[model samples]
Each structure stands twice: as C-alpha cells, then as structure tokens.
Target: MKETDIKELNERIQKESAFVDMLNLEMHKVIIGQKHMLESMLIGLLSNGHILLEGVPGLAKTLAIKSLARTIEAKYSRIQFTPDLLPADLLGTMVYSQKKEEFQVKKGPIFANFILADEINRSPAKVQSALLEAMQEKQITIGENTYSLDEPFLVMATQNPLEQEGTYPLPEAQVDRFMLKVIINYPTKDEEKHIIRENITGAFPETKAIIKPTDILKARGIVREVYLDEKIENYITDIVFATRYPAENKLKKFDGMISYGGSPRASINLALAAKAFAFIKRRGYVIPEDIRAVAYDVMRHRIGLTYEAEAENITTEDIISEILNTVEVP
Candidate 1:
C-alpha cells in the first residue's frame, strides 16, 4: 500500500471506530477492570468469532458478557450447563400443541443474540456439540424446519479451570471451533477493593446501551476491510507453520513437545483476529504488534501438547512464547 492510501485508510478507520470508546466507557461503568478480557471480547465481536473463557468463578465472566450485551443493545441469554443438559435444551425442541393438534417449534435460549454458556464443560458431549454446532453453523434445526440465528450472534462459553470432576471436557476438534480461548485472572488489589466496596454498598453501576446491534454488524464489515500487508500475512503463516513443523522453522526443541500443530482454521482465525485487533486500535493497517497481541489466545487451544510436554509441566503458552520470540517479525 502507498503512503497516501494508508493515511486515507487510517482516517476512515478513525472515524468508523469512534463508537469503540463510547462502548468501552459504558462497559467500564459496570465492569471494574479486566481490560484484556474486555478487549478480547471486542476482538471476538468484531471478528465474528466465538470465545472460550477459562477462569475460576467470581471473575465476572458472566457479568462481562452480560454487560457487553447490554451495552450493545442485544438480547442476552445465559444457559447453565449441567450433567442433564440435553441437546434439545440448548437448541429448540419440537412440542406437540394439543390445541393446534400440530407440532410447534419452541426455540431454546440459543435464539438470543448473545449467549453465555456458563460452565460449558459440565454438560455432556451431546449438549456441548449442540451448542458448538449452533456456534459454527449460526443456525438451529428443529423438527423439519431450520431457523437462522439472529444477526451478530456470539457465544461466550466459560470453563472452570479448577474443576475436573464429572466435567465432560471439550474434544480438541470441538474446541477448535472457538476463535479465542482467553484465560482470565483475578483482579488486581486496587480493582478488588473497588469491587468489594461496590458490592458491600449495594452500589452496582448500571451499564447503559450505547450502540445498536446494527452498529456492531456494520463495524464487523469495516473490520474485515482492515489492511493486511503481505509481510504481515507471511508473518502469520510463519507463526502457524512453526507450530506444525517446529523443527523445520528453527524450533527443533519443540519437535517432540507438540503432539499436533494447529489446523488451517487456526491460521484463518489468526489473520482475522489480527485484523480485528487492528480495528480495535483504530488503525487501518495491521502491524506486527497486533498479531503478537492476539497470538497467544488464538493459538493456545488450537495447539495440542504431547504427553511428554505435559508430564514435564510444559504448557502451550511456553511453546507459543518461544515461537514468537524466535520467529522473525515483519
């Protein structure tokens, strides 16, 4: 891209991305901190990708999703996944209406614009797949008919990192559907102090809706238009290919550590997420920093670790750090 073109695009993006600040302000009215989590949510929202949040309880995962839904003026639904959660429960089921003497399609909570699948791992595989299918297909099938989900539909599924008992963990293939798997941490001491004061005083701030659903739908289009230079594209591919062929990419130490590398979807999501991250930063073109900022969340769940790596207490984060540190930046 020419210098003039980048400047023009930058101006256009700056204008279109103005609402981001307003939306963030409104969200912060209710949410105390977790800037990274909130930013990841915006990236997922703009990229039109579902997210998997891993954290212990009381990290305000549900509250974050709810606050985002409220700020965007979208319908929100929270479905608690349990052992008995059936596929039909997530997706609508057909009911026999005695009065009409016919079957009626009663949509489930999945019909909403934003879904908070709380404790998604607690549910059985059937229930988990049902939600994942809706996430991937963006539609539901009930009876003999198909219903398309509403526009700007997003699923923010949460998993309890501290729990493993009786939880049906998502398979790697199923987990791959999510674009980003963010690991949320406890708030800082200062943030926690505010949280406690707000809770004890019963002074929970309310989030006001700032942007319409159409605004988000429109912003998503602009996010895709963000420039991805050839060098950046190569950089993304190099990062992903390193995961697949570590030894071939100067990452020989990881040759036996990784059981399998990320799939093609990982590459696709990586590019898309970098673009979205650039848009979030109000930049017309993607920079190397944008890709690096989102690389960990985008590739963490996609990469599979070998048993040796796990037994040695190595994590995907460590591998990604090494890859990023070793890979040449554009």
Candidate 2:
C-alpha cells in the first residue's frame, strides 16, 4: 500500500478498533491475569476461528469466556463434557411432541455465539465428533433441517490438565479444526493478590457491547486487508515447512523429535493469526513480530511430538522455538 493509503487504514482501524481496549479493561475487571490467554482469545475471535484452551482448574478460563460474551452481548452457552455424554446430548436429538405428534428439532447449546465446552476431553470420541461439523461447518443439521449458527461464532473448549487420568485425549484430526491451542498458566503473585482483593470486596466489573457482530465482521474484513508483503508470506511458509521437514530447513537436530509436522491448516491459521495480531496492535501491515507472537499457540497443538522426544523430555514448544529461531525473518 502507498503511504497515504496505509496512513488512512491505520487511522481507520484505530478508530474502529477502539473497543479492543474496552474489551481488555472489562475482562480485567473480572479476570486477574493471563494476558497471553486473553489476547489469544481476541485473536481467535477476530480471525473467526475456534480455540482450544488447556489449563488446570481455577485459572479463570471459564470466567474469561463468560466475561468476553458479556462484553460483546453475544449469546453464551457452557456444555459440560462428561464420560456419559452422548452425541445427541451435545447436538440435540429429536423430541416427540404430544400435541403435534411430530418430532421437533430441539437445538443444543451449540446454537450460541460464544460456547464454552468445559472439560471437553472428558467426553468420549463419538460425543466429541459431534462438534466437528458444527465447529468447521458453522452449521448443525437436526432431523434433516439445518440450522445456521449466529455470526461471530466462537467455540472455546477447555480441558483439565491435572486430571487427565480418565480423560479421552482429542484425536489429531479433531484437534486440527481449532485455529489455535492455548496453554494457560496461573496468575502472578501480585495479580493473585488483586484477585483476592476483588473477590473479598465483591468488586467485579461487567463488559458492555462495544461492537456488534456486523462490526466484528467489518473488522475481520479489515484484518484481511492488512498488507502482508511477499517476504513475510515466504517467512510463514518456511516456518511451517520446517515443522514438516526440519532437516531440510537446516534444523536436522529435530529429525526424530517430531513424528509429523504441522499440516496445511497450520500455515493458514498462522498467517491469519499474524494478521489478527497486527490488527490487535492497530498496525496496518504484518511483521515478523506479529507472526512470532502467535506462532507457539498456533503450532503447539498442531505439532505432533515423537515418543522418543517425549522420553527425552522434549516438547512441541521446544521444536517450535528452534524452528522460529533458525528460520530467517523477512
């Protein structure tokens, strides 16, 4: 883009995205810390992608989503995934009506704009698969009738890490549908102190509807319009390719550490997430820093580590760090 156009876009985005700060402030009123997780959630929302959150209990993972929904005035639903959960339980089943004597379609919690699938890993595979269509297709079929989900649809699923003993791990194919997988950590000591003060004093804040779904759609369009030079595109491609063929990318040390590299979807999500990151910062163009900020969350879950690496105490984050450090920036 020319200097004038870039300047205009910058000003326009800055004006339209004023709500970003408001969203942050409102969430902070309720949530203590986890800035990374909060920003990742915004990225997922702006990019129109589903997010999977892995964190232990008391991390405010549930409260964060609720506060976000409250801020946007979007419909919210929380589906508790359990061992006995069935496909029909989540996607809804046909209900027999006494008066009409015909089966009526009773929609499940998936109809909401913001969905919190608590303990998603606790449910069986069959029950989990029920979300595949809704998450990917953005629509659900009920008794031969299809129902389209509301715009700005975002599914934030959380899994408990400490109690994975009886949990059914999400399959790779199922996991790929998510745009990013965020691993949330606990708050800092000072932040925890603030949380304690807030809880004790009953000083919780509410988020208002700063922007509507149409406004979000407009912002998403703007995010796509954010200029990404060819060099940056190549940079993203190289990073993803390294995940698949580490040796070829001059990272031979990671040969056996990774069983498989990130898929094509990983590349797409990485680029989209970078664009969203840039937009979040009110930038008119994407830079290497934008990609770096979101690379771990976008690729961590997508990167399948080998058993050998796990035995050696290596992790997907390690592989991602090496790849990013080795890959030349644009």
Best by lDDT: 1
Candidate 2 has its poorest 10 consecutive residues by lDDT at: 205-214
Question: For every model shown, what is its TM-score relative to the native structure?
Answer: 0.98, 0.97
- Can you write out model 2's per-residue Cα lDDT over 3-50, one digit (the tens) per residue? 898888889889877888988888887787899999999999999999
Per-candidate Cα lDDT values, in order, are 0.93, 0.89
Candidate 1, residues 6-120: lDDT per residue as tens digits? 7888898899899899988988888899999999999999999999999999999889999999998999999999999899988989999999999998999999989999999
Once model 2 is optimally superposed onto the true structure by TM-score, how far is the C-alpha of residue 301 displaced, in angstroms? 0.8
The CA lDDT at 286 in model 1 is 91
Model 2 superposed RMSD (Cα)? 1.3
- Candidate 2 vs. true structure, TM-score: 0.97
